[model samples]
Target chain A: MHDFFFYLFSALTVLTALLVVLCPNAVNSAVFMIVSFVGTAALFLLLDAFFLAILQVLVYAGAVMVLFLFIIMLLDVERSSRVRPDVVTVVAASVAVLLLAFGMGYLFLTGHDATAATMAAVPQVPGGANPMEYATASRAFGYGLFTKYMLPFQVAGFLLLVAMVGVIVLSKRLTGSNEAGKPSAQEIRESEVSQS
Target chain B: MNHSELLTQLSEQYVSTNQWCALWPEIALALLAVLVLLIDLFAGRLRARAVPFAAIAGQVVIFAVLLGKLGTCDPADSGLLFSGMILPTTLSEVMRLFFLLASILVCWLGMLYLRKQDLPRMEFYCLTLIVTAALMLLGQSSNFVMLFVALETVTIGFYILVSYGRNSIFSLEGGLKYLVLGGTSTAILLFGIVLLYGAAGDPSLPVHSGDSLNFLALEQFLAANPNNVLAKVGMVLVLCGVCFKIGAVPFQIWIPDVYQGAPTPVTAFLAVSSKAAGFIVLINLVTGPFGPMASLTVPLLSAITVVTILFGNLTALGQRNVKRVMGLSGIAHAGYLLLGIVALIQGVELAAWAVIFYLFTYLFGSFTVFGVMSHLAGPDDENQEVDHYVNLARRQPFLAGVLAIGLGSLAGIPPLAGFIGKVFLFVVAFQANLYLLLGVAILGVVISIYYYFGWMREAFFQEQTWPEGKEEQLAPIKVCLPHKVAMAALAIITVLLGIYQGGFGGGF
Candidate 1:
């Protein structure tokens, strides 16, 4: 049953992730990305990381997808796919495929014996139950985050704060369109045309 | 046994007041950032002077406190701090001083830079302080979680800083590129961490009980499972992300555009502090958890060094823009530094020292050049192209000399700090028997002279040309006192460090 579920979620994740890149429209791509993230969340559930699964759904599939959709809407890109498969794209794709093959080969060469041995070694509780196993993964996560990971947690907070300031500072316009400030790109192009 | 009891027990075990002192410098920097903001909010008419002055004064205090902390540090209490999150080793202490010095110089340069540019000086200083604190934290982070969080903090601050000149199309374009690339690298790094976690996360080791992300636990895990394919892949991916941060080849497409477009002082900060932070983290990773994997990483680093040095110098040969030249040369310097990393992997004890000493000299040389650039390029005009530097010596002799010294040191001329740093790195490479790498690095240095002197020639050898009716526009450039002071100070540091082979070079 575990193997079946793993294969199912992994297949769905790969399919939707491919769709995200191949979709013609930006909005469609974003929607497909949401689906891919949902597939990822399901995989996380299979790993017994219930909290991370929820986070994958809430933060990535919901919030991050909405943000992507908002940016796509703001830009109002055309459905027309003008992406020509140039030499650079082709080379990059080929290299990526080669790397993936190499990775898979390495995995096969190493085999799953190590993973099986590790699984066999996971300790059981005194009550003859796996209480400290996946059943308590979410609790263990919280415990780890609050204690061992506190410094990084604080640093992550600062990162978000800096990102907020960055968005505001970069997007804010200090000067109006007709001030004695630096010329806009349009104005500069126009002046160059006139000069030519 | 239950959740609340577990939480309580964890808190009792981990939380302590003594450990907080190890974090004093970071806390002080955070407070100083907020204080600068408050001063900006209330200073009203005095906002300009008050903001920068407050920042400089705060930096001085922080520096003193950090120095005191450094002096008082017991060598015996030298392992991981804060539950294995940060490791305040002697190396971190030394690197923190470098970060602080970079901050102090940046604030001074920013003050003079703001005189000509119409920028909100407050936010600039605030971001500088915050980034400095983040960099200081990065130096001590010994865990993957700490490394990622601190790395993101520094990069996010830089995103805004690189595009602070919102009015300029080039600036916004540069920032957009940086954001996209920086975000991609962060994602790659996180994925690598996840993979490593999956490969070695046993939940049995004490550190692993929380999260097997601690460097000590990770090292043990990797040692036990040396042939793990997933762990090797993750290590390579993480190294790639770090390579991007350091502006190495193949991951360095963003450096030139971003460096050229950023405000001059910011360019200096990125060229020095940001790059130094990247190296410090690289040292921590390569020397700490990644040490046992040297057989794999050495060849990888050697390849990166060869390509990075060759690419940085080859492309720089054709660049007209002085900032772009510096950007490419920065990549070349990263290659030279990576040479040290490769040597470290080969078990040369002084390789780490070579990397830090090189960065130390780079800070002075790069800043002196950038300081001169900021002073020359007023808010009204960006003196970007090397052509604009024609007859600079005749017009502004002081600025010209500063640039010459900066470029000369960068080119690794003898009797300069950069040359000393290069010699040490070469010596380490020789010790490691990295003769091929040494040859490539030497060739890179030889190739760098053409362009470094190309700018010097433009500045000192060529005569200024005035268009038929535009001669009036070429009046002698009047540099402000503050600008002069900063330039002179940086130039002095650069030359003095070159001449005096101080205790700084006696490996930490």
Candidate 2:
């Protein structure tokens, strides 16, 4: 059953992800991306990383997709084929994709052996009903985070705060009157250059 | 020890003592950032005058703590804090001092530049403090998790600071490029970390293997498994990511545009503090985790050094913009600094000291040029072109003199601090038998002189051409009080350090 579900989700993931790129319209691409994200989340769920699976859905599929859609709408993106795809770009991209696939294949082959060795090496908890028990899973995460990884956790807060400030500051627009009051120093420099 | 045993031991180590005192500076700065935000939001523009002062005052407090810790903490006393995450060694202490001093200078520069630019002022100070705290955190990170988080915090802060001049297209473009490239490099770095984690494997079963993400543990693992192919790949990828941050060759396409477009103060901060942080982390990784693998990294670093030096200096030769020149020159400096890292790998004891000394001199020299640029620039004008500075000495002697000293140091002229720093690095490289790299570095310095002198010549030698009737409109540049003081301070430090070199010697 697990094997069946894994194949199902993987197939769906690849299908939707392909659609996300191949779709001509911006809105259709965005919709396909959500489906792709959901497929990814399902795969995560199968891996027993339940927290990550839920976050993948809640953040990427829900909030982030909405933001993407908003941007697409605000920009009024059209599906015009103004410029033909260049052969050089296409060739370069294909080579890059092939290289990436080769690298990933090598990584996974070596990584699988390492992971097996690691799993065998880890000392299981005493009196374990199941060594991989999901009980206290989030608790385990919190314990490690608060204790050994406290500094990183706090730094993450500062990172988010900076992002917030950046977004607010960048999105702000100056009042029309403020812009019209006088020529800015830059304008003056340009005018001087032109006059000269 | 088993995984549980390791956790228990680390927890006991953390909970036993008040190790939190060692992190007082970072904590205070974090709180100061929050306070600045609150003040900015609540007080609005009414209390604008108080914000920068508060930021400067917080930096002063941090600086005081750094000074107090200097020469006081014995090497043996310096150890891990917050479990195994932080190693606040004396090395970190000195590096933190540099960060603080740089931050304080940035605040002064930002304040003057902000007022002139008429941009939002409060968040500039707040973010600078946050980034400084992050720098402190980065200097002390002994674990990969701490390193990544602290690095991200600094990068995020800079992304905002880079585009702070929101109205400028150049600023926005620079910020976007930095963000996209920085994000990609970060992903590459994380991938490398994951591979290393896999190669190290689980430490819990206690076959005496290293932990997944701890620097010390990784070092032990690398020493034990010298031929681990996966670990080698991981280390290479990690170096690539860091090279992006340091603006080394092959990862340097972003530097020129970003440096020229970022608010001049932000450019200075990025040029000094950001580059310093990258080098510090690189030193930590190369010396700590990859020490035993010097056989692997030495050749890699040598190739990078040669390319970075040749590429930076040669490309800079054709640049018309002053900021672009500084940006490319910074890349060349990174090459020189990398030579020191090679020396470190070759078992030279003074290599790290040489790097620190070089960075210290770089701070004063680069900031001298940046501070003058900040003062001369108006709200919408960068005044960054080489032509903009023609006959600047006739119009503003102080600014011109500061620029000359700054560029002179950068060009590695004798009797300046930069020259001394370069000599020390080259000596260490020579001691390590890196004659080829030393020769390359000397060539880079020579190439750099032509442009540096070009800038000086434009400022002092060229006649100020005011088109026919426009001569009456041109007025002498009026520098603000804070900028004046800051420029003067940097000039004095550069000259005095060049003459004395006492403090640098004693610190080692």
Q: What digit string (tens of lDDT, one per residue) describes model 1 on residues B443-470? A: 9999999999999999998865666756
lDDT tens digits by residue: candidate 2, A1-196: 9999999999999998899878878899899999999999999889787887888999999999999999999879789475667999899889989987887677556643443443454355554434444223565566667766666887898899988987877654433224553445565345434532
Off by over 4 Å in 1: A99-118, A124-143, A175-196, B1-3, B68-71, B75-80, B202-210, B378-383, B465-471, B505-508
Clashes of each: 0, 0
**Residue A82's C-alpha lDDT in candidate 1?**
72
Model 2 segments more than 4 A misplaced: A1-32, A80-122, A126-130, A134-136, A173-196, B1-18, B42-46, B75-78, B202-210, B506-508
What are the models' TM-scores? 0.92, 0.89
TM-score of the A-chain for all models: 0.74, 0.69
Tell the DockQ for candidate 1. Answer: 0.37
| Clashing residue pairs in candidate 2 (N, C-alpha, C atoms within 3 angstroms) | none
Q: Residue by residue across B1-508, what tens digits does model 2's lDDT show?
A: 2445545655565565437777888889989999988887787656677788888987897798679868875744745566667887667788999999999989988877776664666789888999999998898888888889999999999999987876566777788899999998898888889878877764522223445788888888888777566787888889988999898887888999899879888898999999999889888888899899999899989999999999989989999888888899899999999999999999997898899999999999999998888766766644478887878897889999999999999889988889999988998899999999999999999999999999899999997666776645555588877668879889988988888898566533
| Global Cα RMSD, each model | 3.5, 4.6
| Interface DockQ of each model | 0.37, 0.31
